[model samples]
Target chain A: MKAVRTIAELREQIGEMKAASAKATIGLVPTMGYLHQGHASLIRAAKVKTDIVVVSIFVNPIQFGPGEDFETYPRDEARDLAAAEAAGADLVFLPSVDTMYPKPTKTKIAVSEVTSGLCGASRPGHFDGVTTVVGKLFHIVQPDYAFFGMKDAQQVAVIEQMVYDLNFNVTIVPCPIIREEDGLALSSRNVYLSPEERTQALVLSRSLRETKEAVKTGQIRTAGEAKELLTQIIGESPLAVIDYVEIANFPELSPLAAETAILEQEESVLMALAVKFGKTRLIDNCLIQPKGE
Target chain B: MKAVRTIAELREQIGEMKAASAKATIGLVPTMGYLHQGHASLIRAAKVKTDIVVVSIFVNPIQFGPGEDFETYPRDEARDLAAAEAAGADLVFLPSVDTMYPKPTKTKIAVSEVTSGLCGASRPGHFDGVTTVVGKLFHIVQPDYAFFGMKDAQQVAVIEQMVYDLNFNVTIVPCPIIREEDGLALSSRNVYLSPEERTQALVLSRSLRETKEAVKTGQIRTAGEAKELLTQIIGESPLAVIDYVEIANFPELSPLAAETAILEQEESVLMALAVKFGKTRLIDNCLIQPKGE
Candidate 1:
């Protein structure tokens, strides 16, 4: 595996590779360094379907807000490169801040409608930053397919909308979310969790699992009841502070009415939660699809 | 020469062509259908530097204001296709509105700073629509070079900024403005003018030519003096009503102070004017560059 840090060099390399093999299928996996098993799973999935795999690692600063964890985000290039190689990434693009943004960038890709609630509400311009950086990476890599883990389901939806709206000639593959043994979704920010906070964080996935179980048993029939049930389960942990608990229509993220019964009225909806254990903010979601559909 | 109306067919053709010759460089010229010599000049320029030239004819309704001339924008597919071929284009993409915008588009490429004044101020959301459609074309065609005329100087500036900020791989070629023998800049919209209105439209380019001559002779030293000269020359035509006549810095479109001397104080500046004769609106501009600097 080869690693490049400049846009020009990476572009030239990609250009040369395409020139050599016109039939080559390139897959791109964009990420911020601090490679967890979730990222590895994305790379492994791309390797299964593509002739070449390229992974980009850059902690995008624009996505981080004024009080967010922009400055203190994790970084370990050597370990990341080795892990990417082990997981079958052919080229690793690790661009410097100056290389990625030589000047103040004024062009922005703004996605509407679907970005209104959930993570978009709390992080403010978070999805804007993600979409912009992802746009740049797409143009740079010019891949045939791009793989993304469903851990950030909203990000996947926003990207899908952008690609469709912009008419990009690439396909977006949303892979399943990878998790720890205890069912906690794997995230790079997991490093920030202390021993006590780590244990408290399990409540996030536990609440999601409980919601899924409740829906399976037909106990939670409406969005309001679902939210109430989640709030009660998460509030049991003294360290867990619920930021938001939403039950909205899948993909569109539209709010489901409290009085509207959804027990077999609809196929399924999305149940998402955001909670804070100290300064680390984490999000988790599950799509409740009808069985055997 | 070949003409394709669907995106899938165009992409497939382009894909096969690229596969046959990886070194082939494709150039794209985007336009709305009524092709005049101005578009011809852009096509000719592209032919000089690329292996294959693709021209896209889209009316782009989103760029037009609520009360603007969108529904009545002149279009002739046969004339456009023949003109594009005669101008040395290899392919012409004439996508229908339904094909181009299959559904409501949610992705937008918003460019700021350069789009704040001039036509942008009068025609709100115009540049946003242009940038979005151009972005879609760029991704679909994946050309090596894209050409634009200096006739719409602000549009060229905004596109250049977008390509740079978004890291598009294609190079943008800014071609010279094409003009009629009477000094009127050739535009598809020029067809709207009656014979008398056409004659009165000469003031648009005459002001730009006079501005160039004044700057050359050091006659107009201040922005106020330049505007006064243009206003006097254009106001002489009873049929002509001056919309905007101002001097500003190049590219950035920053307003220059009225008292600031322009002849020797500044290396270059943009002198632009918009005028309406009868119901037809016209615009023309000239960049004043320091000679032999």
Candidate 2:
């Protein structure tokens, strides 16, 4: 992969690739530079549908809170380059923080209702960070489609709603979460977990899976029951602490107080949660469909 | 001119136009449907540079306050259509308010510092409305360049700042304000003025001209003097009630205080004022460059 450091260089590279390509479509898979299987899946998905794939490997500073590993966010340029090449990416952009966010960046793209809920509830400006950085990436890359992992379901939904509302000319494609053989979702933050906390992290994916299974078997009737089942399972895992449990409309992300009303539109319920396994906060989600017609 | 009412149809037309002629750039001029010479200038400029020119006539509701002219804003389709054809516009889009802003448009694209001042000060959420509506137009039309008149200088600056900060993929073209032969700027709201107020409204432009003269002969040194001159001019005109007099940064629209030190980076100054002559609010501006070394 040709690693580009400046936005102009990256845009020039993308422009050249677009000019030379048959499809003329540009895809972006933005990440913070630790290329794990989750990142790889997004890149692979992007390569399938678009002619030119640009992978941004910037560790966005605004996304990280003051004490939240902004400095320690991993950067392995050689490995990331190799991975992007293997994933069939046409360009790799590694912009300097200065280039992406100049000192005078006072403007922000905010999606109001959906952002104030979910992890946004816990992380304060987390979704704002996600949106603002993603917006910059979208503008710089000018991608026809952007690939994101469904593991951050709320993030994906927030991004989709933002695109729909803000009129960004990009499609958001949410790929299923990439997982380990034992079913733990793959994340770069997984590196921060201790061996014991890593084991305890299984509760997140396992609880989501069990709730999905219960809903399929009619053991879960309402959103409350489905949430309760997951709650009980997660409570049993001594090492995990719950942050929020939500089953919400796909677009609005408003938690369903009653059983989800009929899905009139192309809407599904998001069964999502964030849990603290030791000091690392891990999020997981599953989509809930209505009973078979 | 081909008239389109639906956003999907407008986008489809823009898409086909782009596909057929990639180098045939598009220039968009967005307006509320009250075609005047000021709007004609923007359409003419767009006609000069691009293969296709689109004029979106949407009277955005979000920008208006209660008791404001949201419902009463003038709409003359016959006049507008003739003017657009005369100006060589390829298409005229008169989208319905509901079509432009669907229900629950919670996403607002805002330029923070620039918006918080100026018309933003007197009219809350005005720039947000401007940014959001223009952003929708930018997405739906996907114009290579968009035009705005210098009469709405703060709005043009806010838009330029938004395009820069949000990384919108379009060049903002700030066209010169088209004026009547009387030195009064042409505006759609000019129709609301009574004959007597219409004559007195000339004070707005004349004050700006006099301010230029004052600064030339060293009568005005600071922004305060320029503001004071504008206020005194309106005060002398019995029919005119001053709304605001602003001396600000040319691009950022940040308020300039006389006591503040002049930094080298802050060179251009914008002097704008709004005065109500009867039911109509007349506005005008003059840009001043700093003294030479």
Candidate 3:
């Protein structure tokens, strides 16, 4: 495995690799460092599908809002490098703040509609920063396939929309969300949670799981009912301050009416949540397919 | 020469061409049909520098303002194809409005600072449209070198800034502005001019040339002095109605102070104009290099 910290070096290295094997398919896994099981899962998926797996680790600052955790975002380069290589990344890109952005970026890539709710609403300009940095990574690597985790489900949707709308040549491969044995969604920010808050965080995934089961069993027939049930379940935890409990159509992310029947809708439904346990904000979601004909 | 109207076919054709020659360098000349000597010059430059020359003709609607001439924009497919071939183009992409945009695009690429003034101010969202469509073309063609005419000088600057900021892998080659013997800049919209209006349009280029000569001879010193001379020279034409006469730093497109000495600036300076001949609007510019050490 090789490591690079500059854009020029990464391009040259990718070019040389492609020159040696003209038909080699490249895969990219873009991430902020402090790699956990979630990131490793994405890298492992890329290893199975591509000839060259390049993992880029840069904690882009622009994505964080004014009061967000820009200064305190977790990062561990040494651990991340080892984890990326062990998970089958052929190359790991570790660009510094200065290397990634010598100057502030004036160009922005925005995907509308899909970016209007959920995490986008909770944290403004977050998706713009994600799309812009992802765009830069796409250009720098020119990868054949880019892997993403459904852990950031809204992010996956926004990126897919951007790729489709922009006619980008690369394909987006979305992997499943990784989770702990107790069903708590794996996140680097989980490290920030106090021991008590950590246990309460499991309510997020539990509520989503129960909601999916309720919809499947026809007990929760409408979006409003589901939201009410989720609110009740998450409300049980004292430390879990609910930021948003949204039930919207998948991909398009248009809000569903309160009385809209989830099982009758042709498109898939997304039940997403953003909750704060003290200062750490954690998000999780599930996609529910409509009942088939 | 070959012609393709759909994105899929163009991609397949370019793929086959690249497969045959692994090291072939591709060049792209993006235009809005109605090919003239100016577009031909761009094509010819591409032929000299690249192994495959692909010219795309798309009159992107998003770039036009509410009352702009998008509907009346001139187009001649047969004539354009012939001219493109004659100028050494290997392929021409002629996508229809539906082909280029099957649906309203939700994604937008915006470059700030460089697109804030000059034509950008006169035509709101114009550069955004240009950058978005051009970005789509860059992904679609993945060309090695993209050729552009200096006729739209601010456009060149905006694109260069986007490519730099976004880390697009292609090089932007700015060709000199093509002009007629009478010093009139070549434009597809030239077809809109009446014979008398055409004669009057020559003032656009004439004023630029005189301004360039005056600055070179040290007769024009400050930005305010140059604007005054340009406004007065172009005022001689009875049919010409001034829209804007701006002097700004090149590429940055930031306005120069009224008293700022043009010759002392280290960066190249741009003197740009937009004027209406009856109902037809035309634009032109001249770039002045700083005195060398």
Candidate 4:
């Protein structure tokens, strides 16, 4: 398990690997270092789908909001590499800030509708950071496929849109979320919890699952009811401050008003939620569908 | 020269060419069809510097203004090929509007400071179109080097800034402007002119010569004086409606003001002018330097 520290080093290794085997498809799993099962799931998915899997570990500064975890984002390089190796990744790239952006880069990819609505509304310039850094990673790795965790569903959507729009010629594969035994979404920020905050954070994932169940069993009338129930669930946790609970349709990401949208689009009312536990903002979601369809 | 009509075909040809010789270096000259000495000059420059020169002939629709010549841009494949082969181009790409765009492309590249001034101020969304289409062309060709005519001087500067800011690895080579015996800048739009309009269009080039003479003879004191003389020169032509005549710092594209910008920077100032003759707008420029420097 060798750790590559620079963009040049990663590019050289990938180029050599490409020369050795013409059919050696590369799969990239981008991460912000502190590894958990959610990231582990993404690595494993990439490993299974491609000939070589490269995991990038960078605590991206641009994506962090001013009041957010820019400074305190957890990083454990050794642990991350060990976990990546355990999950069957062939290479681990840990680039310095200079390695990622030596100078100010002006090029950015933006998705108009999908980006402006969800997390983008809360974290200004956050998706811009995600898009820019992912673009740099995509260029450096030159991967055949890039795997992303659906925990940040908006991020996955943005990257997919950017890839399609930019003609990058790389496949964007979205992997599923890996949760705790309590149905709490696994995140590196979970460690920031003071046991009580950890417990409060579970409300986000739990309410989402409850909303899914409500929709599944015909307990909810419209998307509005599910939204109300999810709000109430988080309100029960005193320490949990909910930011937003949105049910948006697939790809278009428009707010789900009823079971159907205009244009007879294949609508997906993703029950997405965001809640703050202490200083850290955690996010989670579950898909809800109409009873018959 | 082998013409590739689609990106798929071009990519396949590139694969075979790369396999045959790893030492082969690809150069690209992107142009709209009706090839002239200007296009040929770029192609010839590409042939000298790289092993494989691919000339793309697609009149980009995005770059044309609403009432501009998008509908009337010239095309003649046989004539273009004869010019391309004579100039030593190895591959000629003549993709259709569908092949180049396929659909409405969402991705775009923008250079803030450089593009906002110059022709950008007049042609709304023009440089955006150039940046977007050239980006796609670079992706498709994946050339080692790309060539452009300095006749579209602002376009060269915009692309240079974009390539630098975006970390695109291709070397940008700016070729000298190709002109007719009478000093009019060669352009595909020249074909649209009546003989009288064609002769009147010579004012665009002649104004630059006047500015050059004024600066050389120490008669011009400031940018205003130079532009005023140009306005007078174009006013002499009955059909020529003067658009703009100004000198500016090369990459910055800032007007050469006596109070603000130092005379030292005037060495890099580009004297660019645009004129309209009964509908067709023509642009040209001359690079200025300080006297005895």
Tens digits of lDDT, candidate 1, A19-127: 6876889999999989999999999999999988999999999888999998999999999999999999999999988887898888999899889899999889999
**Candidate 1's TM-score:** 0.97
Q: Best to worst by TM-score, what's the order?
A: 3, 1, 2, 4
Tell me the interface RMSD of model 1, in angstroms: 0.5
Clashing pairs in 3: none
Per-candidate alpha-carbon RMSD to the true structure: 1.6, 2.4, 1.2, 3.1
When just chain B is superposed on the true chain B, each candidate scores a TM-score of: 0.97, 0.95, 0.98, 0.95
Which candidate number has the best TM-score? 3
What are the DockQ scores of the candidates, in order?
A: 0.91, 0.68, 0.88, 0.41
Off by over 4 Å in 2: A258-267, B259-266
Lowest lDDT 10-residue stretch of candidate 2 chain A: A258-267
C-alpha RMSD in Å of predicted model 2 compared with the true structure: 2.4
| Per-residue C-alpha lDDT of model 4 across residues B1-293, encoded as one tens digit per residue | 79889888998898789889876899999998899999999999999999999999998998988988888778888999999999999899998888777667655555566777779888978988898788778777788899999999999988887776555658899999999999999999898899999888888888788777776767776677777787888888989876777678886687777443323453577888888887888889978755423
TM-score of 2: 0.94
Between prediction 2 and prediction 3, the one with superior lDDT is 3
Interface RMSD of each: 0.5, 1.3, 0.6, 2.2
- Report the poorest 10 consecutive residues by lDDT, candidate 1 chain B: B260-269
How far residue A264's Cα lies from its native spot in candidate 4, in Å, is: 9.7
Off by over 4 Å in 3: none
- Which lDDT tens digits does candidate 2 get at residues A102-167? 775777777888987888888777777788889888878888999999988888888998888877
DockQ-superior candidate, 1 or 3: 1
